[model samples]
Target: MKDAHSNRVLLLSLLIGFIVVSLFVLGVRTLVPPDEGRYAEMAREMFASGDWITTRLNGIKYFEKPPLQTWMNALSFTLFGVGDWQARLWTGLCGIIGVLLTGYAGARVYGPRVGLYAALVLGSSFYWVACSQINSLDMGLSGMMTIALCALLVAQRDSATPTEQRNWMLLCWAGMALAVLSKGLIGLVLPGGVLVFYTLAARDWQIWTRLHLGKGLLLFFAIAAPWFVLVGLQNPEQPHFFFIHEHFDRFLLKEHKREAAWWIFLALLAAGCVPWLGVLVQSLLQSLRRTPGAAQERFRPGLLLLVWVVFIIAFFTKSSSKLPGYILPVFPAVALMIAHYLETASRRSRSVNAALLVLLGAAFLGFVPFMLRLAKRAGEDLLYQQYQPWVLAAGIVALAGGVLALVFDRRLQRDRAVIALALGGFFATHLILAGFEPIGQARAGVGMVPAIRAEIMPTSTIYAVGLYEQSLTFYLGRPVVLVDYLDEFSFGLQQQPALAIPTVDAFVVQWRAHAAAGVRDIAITRDDIVAQLKKDGVPVRIVAADARRIVIANF
Candidate 1:
């Protein structure tokens, strides 16, 4: 009882500290581009335009994704009045919700101890914590999928009454609906695929009857169908671009250019799991064995979880588009599996987990010297230099945490070992990510924002030439004209031909004309463009210049 009480106190303290740090970091970093800036700016545009159905990025019709994130962000802005923290609130909440839901579900399905461990494992994992604060659609998608996954677990647990199963299954459906809105069809498709694989592998066809498909499907369509319908009606072209182009092409073709080596996510899982990386394979292997429960209880949760992890990894691996976060949906499952393993984990297993963190920290310390070589562009060497100490500090923290955890594990104070490792892993990732502000701020064009904001008149025509600094428009609270730039916006620009300047010649004509009319023309363009404009006597007065870009004015 005394040990339990002490552990509870430590857990509560860690929970409080984690929440405080998590909330504080959401606002600390400048919204990084292109993902952070792009999504936040989309929300800002939605909030400003009051058109929730048709999403736009930089004043172009953006149908690349659904509007769930945009709606949530726009609503956040409405309530909180448009700041970086407010923009991140939705994804942040999603992250928190996922943790709580996973914890609750694990407790209900497994045991209270396992539930607690699951939450601790997930909340501290580098990937989960990092994505939680980031203003990305991945977190939103992962969050909703978490709800779906956990609901299914609770609904299927052996102790659940028929009523409990039905209601939770309904929630499971609603979560899929929200997931669809959050990302796209994958919300439903991925879960549905997992169910199919689970049934075949476990040979539990009876699981089908318990899913409450009729009412669940009705509820799902009711929630998910409206947005796709409204958006399609508002812009008939959205369906083709979204359903066919975005989904099919992105998966089947290498045109998205996100393709990585097939082993990429395998590597990410190893790193992203952090301290748990040592136990990952063993936990998954443990799932391959039958877990103790009623012989009549045909719902094999371990099999289901194993299938979830394998299927998601396999599904994304087969796709030509591979990104780090594609496997994010598996973290919750992995955490649950790890927690179950830790319930009976030997001292050796615990020692290895602690040791991995130490090695990771040492690796970070080792890599500190190579940061200078990581700079792709000029002036970034300084940013890398600035980032080294943060990495060093993170390494030290992880090393210390691992050493402490090893000591506790050796002493057989299992709970303390886990808690110590959790704290260490959590802080190590947070420090490294937070320390990235210098580099993120530089990439985000935040330094230029104040200077750029001061020079802009109400009628100033802002044009992004050759490149779009995604976060720049978000910081300024306005969209810019696109000049000779149509990378992701090509489909949107094809539909709205008038939203962009089309070519440099056309932009130059407009800039020269605006100058004559006493209008301020601000063009944030490449250094080469600024140089050429000056060399060609094109009337560009440089306002601010950076190694990568130059903010100029027509005067």
Candidate 2:
């Protein structure tokens, strides 16, 4: 009994440690561009402009994603201030909440020890932890989906009373609603599909009767509809583009250019699971059979988990729009299965997991040089060199963890072994992310921000000529005039042509006019554009420059 008590305390300690480190790391790195910077800037723009109805990036309408992440991020900015950590605050909380939610559900459905392990597994995972610190929609969506998943797990168990079932199902519906707001329709589609498939596969149609669907759907719509209605009412084109182009077309067509082999998710799952990957396949196999205690219950948690993971992976695998983050929502369900296996795993199995962690860590160390050589962009070699020591340290941490886990496993201390491996895995993830700061700093145009900030006047127009650096715009606290740069913003630009200069020739004419008027205007463009401008005899004084972009002014 004392040993069991000690184990529980130790698991709780590890869970707390994972969360503390997660929060601390939120402020450790500069925001990475494309997703992190793009989302952060949208929140910043919405916060600054106070036009929460329509979201804009660089002063152009951006409808690529639903606004839950942006809304939460904007709320964070409102409560705190606009900064890197502030931008990531929403995703971080979602991750932490997810861990807690999964843990609670596991305890309710499985056992207390299994619940703790589930939380530790999910909290320490590379995909979940990394996305948590990033200011992106993936973590936000996954977090909400987890709420739905866990709520259903707890509510549908034979152990749950009538009142508990009603309340938890309502919460489950609400979670799906917020999830829809997080990314898009998949938030509802994936979970609903999982339920349908689970029903068919389990051959338990009567389980549907217990779901309280009428009240649940009402709660779902109440939470999910207002924004869709308002956004669609104000902008008529949103309904088609968001529901059709973003969802259906994005799934069926190769226009996104994000297609990959059907097995891409399989690869990601293995890599993302890290130390836990050793037992992952076994866990999935184990889930195929009913649990020891669940035979009496009509609603099977193991079967539900199996269906959840398989349904999500298969759903994304079929979609042409494939990305690494698309597979994130499945990890929490994977964690629960792995946790159940770990609870009763043989000593030999535990030892093997420890040994795998050591090998993985050493292998990572061996790849450091190749990682350094992967700097494709010019001037990034130095940044990669700076990143080496962190990766080396991470490998060492992994090695240490494996050794400790091996020691604990040999002693027949299961939870201790598990905790040691989890700490090592999570800290290794934190180190790699923290180490990426040098690269992130460069990509975000960090050094040039100060120079550009100094050059800005209240009336000065900022132009993103043939380029747009999302983080740079956010840091400057100002919007830029789009000069012949339209990628993801193309749809938004189609509706508002006045927001951007259509061509470089047109931009050149405007630049000359501004120069003649003695009005200071800043333009961020590529080196080739700077050369072309100088060749064309357009007046442009270089103020600041980085590897990817140059900031120029008409003074």
Candidate 3:
């Protein structure tokens, strides 16, 4: 009875700690550009327009991805009034769900201690923590995919009753459906491909019969098919662009323009698993010793996990378009595998973890001066200098935790040692991410918003020329008319020719007409364009200027 009470206390403490930490950090930093701002604006617009079926960006028809994330973001905006932290609620919640689900799955598969450790490992991993706090589609997709994968593993366990197995299978299908809604077809493709590979590799053809296919398919289509069908019917062009351009062409061609050498993902994995590298390497080696054989014939979850990791890496490696977060779906599996290994390992593994933590701490502390030089070289010395204290604090905390873990290991308190190291990792990673506030402030255009907002009323015509600040639309509380610029939104403009000015000369003509008509109009462009516009004899008043951009209004 006492042991159970202690276990409950531990679980409650961890849950509360995770929620508090996640909430505190959610609103502390500005949203980063490109992914964060773009997705958030999409959601903001969704809320503004109240059109949930068709996803639009800056009031232009955007069919690149599905609207699952946008829907949630819109819902969050409706409930929480559309601030930075509110915009990020879906992602943070998904991440939390992912961690808890991983722990639960781990507990069921390995044991309670292993489950808790797996959750801790995932929560502390650099990529996972950073992605969870930002407004990004990857976290939502990764979290849903993790749920789908973990559900499959739990359902396939031997101890489940026939009825329980059916229910678990339904959960798996629902997870995949939500995942598909989160990103696109890749969610389904990745998991289905991994399953096929596992089936063939393990020579487990009979396992197919165990899946409740009929009911599962009905459930999947019920959740995932409605949006695709509804959206496609409303926008005829969506079917072609989404399936072909977004999926096939994105993978087969270099059209998305995110091409990178194969080795980039390798670097990302190493950096993402920092402080756990040594333990993970040893765990993987230990995992390899238990191959699928007759001795352990009920099921080989480890082999399944290995196949999951290998297939995802290989699949994305072959794709022409790649990003660092594309491989996140594999992380939960990696955590589970590591936790499983840790559960059965000797005391030497704890020593290795402590050593890795010490190495990480020493590296951070020892290279402080060098990091400052690099920061200076990158022309971000001020931001880096301000960030230095947090970096040092993270290092000191990590070193302290490592030393504490070592002491606990000596006292034969394995769980305490593991928890100490896990807490160290969590704090260190969050500190580094929080230190990015200065960088985000400078680059994300949050500072420029208030000045620009004061100069232009809600009724004023605003044009973003030559460049797009991804966060500008959200901050301004409305869309900016794009002038002579179309990158990713080219398809939208092509479909609706009236939404943008096609050339600078065209914009000049419009500007003169608006000025003549006594209309208040603002244009945001690069500083060079402002100079050229003045030289070309256009009447303009500079409203605000940042280092990289200038906002001009017709005089």
Q: Which candidate is the best by lDDT?
A: 1
Give the higher-TM-score candidate: 2 or 3. Answer: 2
Cα deviation at 199, candidate 3, in Å, is 1.5
CA-lDDT, candidates in order:
0.90, 0.89, 0.84
| Model 2 TM-score, all chains together | 0.97
* TM-score of candidate 3 relative to the true fold: 0.96
Which has the higher lDDT value, candidate number 1 or candidate number 3?
Answer: 1
Error of 2 at 163 (Å): 0.9
Q: lDDT value for candidate 3?
A: 0.84
List runs of model 2 lying over 4 Å from the truth. 1-12
Stretches off by above 4 angstroms in model 3 are 1-6, 289-296, 371-379
Per-residue accuracy of model 1 over 1-555 as CA lDDT, tens digit each: 245323667668766777778888899789999899999999999999999889999989999899999999999999989998998999888888888888888888888878888888998999999999899999999999999999999999878899999999999999999999999999988999999999999898889999999999999999999989988998999999899998999999999899899888888888788878989999999988887655677677888899999999999999999988898999999999998899899999999989988898898899999989989887999999999999999999999989999999988988778878888888988899988998998888888988898899999989999999999889988999999998999999999989998899899988999999999979999988887888878998888877767999998
Given candidate 1, what's the lDDT at residue 41? 97
lDDT against true structure, model 1: 0.90
